[model samples]
Target: MSTFHPFPRLPIELRLRIWSLTAFPRMIHVKRQCVGDHGEFGLQYMATSTPCPPVVQVCQESRRYAPYRRAFTTGAEPRYIWVNFESDMICNDGSHDLLNLEPHQQDIQRLRLPIDDELAYDYITIHGDQEFKKFTNIKEIHIAVDLQFAGFSIEFLAATVNKCFNGFDNKVKFLDVGSGYMMDANQLRILSDWKNYYSFDTHGRANVDTFEGAIRFMRILDNILTLSEMHAIDDENAKIKQDQQFL
Candidate 1:
């Protein structure tokens, strides 16, 4: 008798389930990358426990079940993806046109947008809307505003919100202000007005003034984002089950 490898004989559905079970945690960091002077663009994710999981690289069958680089790559429509902006000019200039992400990427259900100051926010406002309108399935936008930047302007909040809803016809489910500087009375009023006007859910630190406050605020935001991703995944799984039953 010959010893056999039973894993390979498993059904594709089971294989995928196993792969998903072994998947690196869903909450992941993503960033933009450019290659060559011609400016070929690509998405890069922060290193994970197994950046290229053995499942993906092991064999053709298992590879099909592996989540490829696109899963969390910049333009890939991953389930839950986080992008943190610490600088106004770190990646692409706001003047740069939004990259043409795949339709699924545009349909990301959960997103953690960057936290930037006035200039960076302005850049996004000027150049990011066109790309944002493509996000048809966006359910939530978690914004992390960096309070350390003293140049934050009130206009950033309204402009960002408007851009997100511009052509999507209010498809977004929530506009969460996850972290930012402690708002003055006026800013708080504006935030209140927007929440009412947009009729969307929000969660975040209302006040973050000191250095210690900023650090603590970030930890809280991270936890919230993680929970959001978990909820989204559970919702998706439920939906999938429903669809399967319908079929």
Candidate 2:
């Protein structure tokens, strides 16, 4: 009776609830740093606490709460794995991260691919396909691509996607495609063709021909573009203010 343990005295359900809250999932942006001295790549900025979770640091009885462990085990939110395919020799090596996932982490369900013009296809053919084959539990794939930069023919992209998802039959679910660059009539038609071929559930689809659904996509795009412009303007104004302060 020497110790004062108010938290332990609480009901078991309340204690579990408190532990789960401490391990809430946050949006994490992953970037690959250069090859290390051992020539092995390393991840730089994954959004997780430096040490362990506070609850885990508690006594053994608190550690027995499995939900606390499961929640904090994954760096990214469950059901959404993000990969940046932009060609930046400095900070864009997400392809490498996807390739090197541990066996337990390989069973990802949803993927968000953000690709630029250069090296998109090359990266997909080599690294992406390899990862996809390993992702036997993959369910949905979301893409935001710059087709204009790579000058990728519609046929080429379709073939690449098919190849990447070759191993999984119905396990591969919806394809949510959006574009950073403007798409022409022909390009839109190509997406339509792919949708028809896959016959995916459009309830989870975006930027597709379904007029009602497309409206939702357009609204989201508009908000993103607007926010981007606002941020740029804010940065410019801040710079000017700083310069004036110096004067």
Candidate 3:
């Protein structure tokens, strides 16, 4: 009898899933290699005013993930689509451009839009914004970056929360304030003001004021406990199912 070695092969979907699992793993590591590596332009694409597509391209290229880069690097629509949603992030250009598209083989998982103009966002929400509901399968989202002068604005944050959660009244599970340049009471309120909101990641200068000493340290423990609870329950269920198979 000849011993056989199983060849390592992953289905396209599985391979894509694995890639996404670590897609932005080093989210905290700011890659400063882009040309305008100075001031606000350093961390973002100045012209595009959007971070996801370009950031993904740069990182993918940095890792020599060329082919994958091209997969999303092209096409006018969904230039860089999140696999989970299979929905291309759309900029709020007066119309719900992304929502018009029909779902393909991949399931629509999430949706994102910019918090460009604060006033408009407020108007939409205050008037019982039915517009946001167009995002059919939205789940996870990245909204108004809080970083000013270079950071996300307060109005933008409020509107983003309202738009993404369908209302500011709802609770959001995961949120990233991300290197936002905090100044003034209004700016701070956006992060601290929310109710039932968890996870305050103060990665930028403003965070210095918010997360001092034990605050960050204790938060780390809380995160670990949450992770343990989630996984322990899943592991127990798997074990029970395995025993039932033998019985």
RMSD of each: 12.3, 18.7, 13.5
- Regions of model 3 farther than 4 Å from truth: 1-108, 116-129, 149-177, 180-247
**Poorly placed runs, candidate 1 (over 4 Å):** 1-6, 9-13, 20-30, 35-50, 67-107, 117-119, 166-247
Across residues 1-247, which tens digit of lDDT does each residue of candidate 2 receive? Answer: 7755797789899887776555433223333333464325543323322334456667776567623323212333233222211210111235434344443334444444545454555677677766666655555444445444535544455566566655543333222234224332223444546455543466663235442344345455442233345458779999999999989
Best to worst by lDDT, what's the order? 2, 1, 3
For candidate 1, the clash count comes to: 0
- Every model's TM-score: 0.46, 0.44, 0.32
- In the range 1-247, model 3's lDDT, one tens digit per residue, is 4732331254656545544544432111111122332333322211233344333444443234322232222222333333213334333322212222233212323433333444434444553255445544554444433232233343344544545454422222323345342222222343444311444455423322322222343345443234346458769999999999999
Task: Answer with 2 or 3, whichever has the higher lDDT.
Answer: 2
Range of the 10 consecutive residues with the lowest summed lDDT in candidate 2: 83-92
Q: In lDDT terms, how accurate is model 1?
A: 0.45
What is the lDDT of every predicted structure here? Answer: 0.45, 0.46, 0.36
Alpha-carbon error at 238 in model 1, in Å? 25
**Pick by lDDT: 1 or 3, better one:** 1
- In angstroms, the error of model 1 at 33 is 3.7
- Say which candidate scores most in TM-score: 1
lDDT of 3 at 183: 25
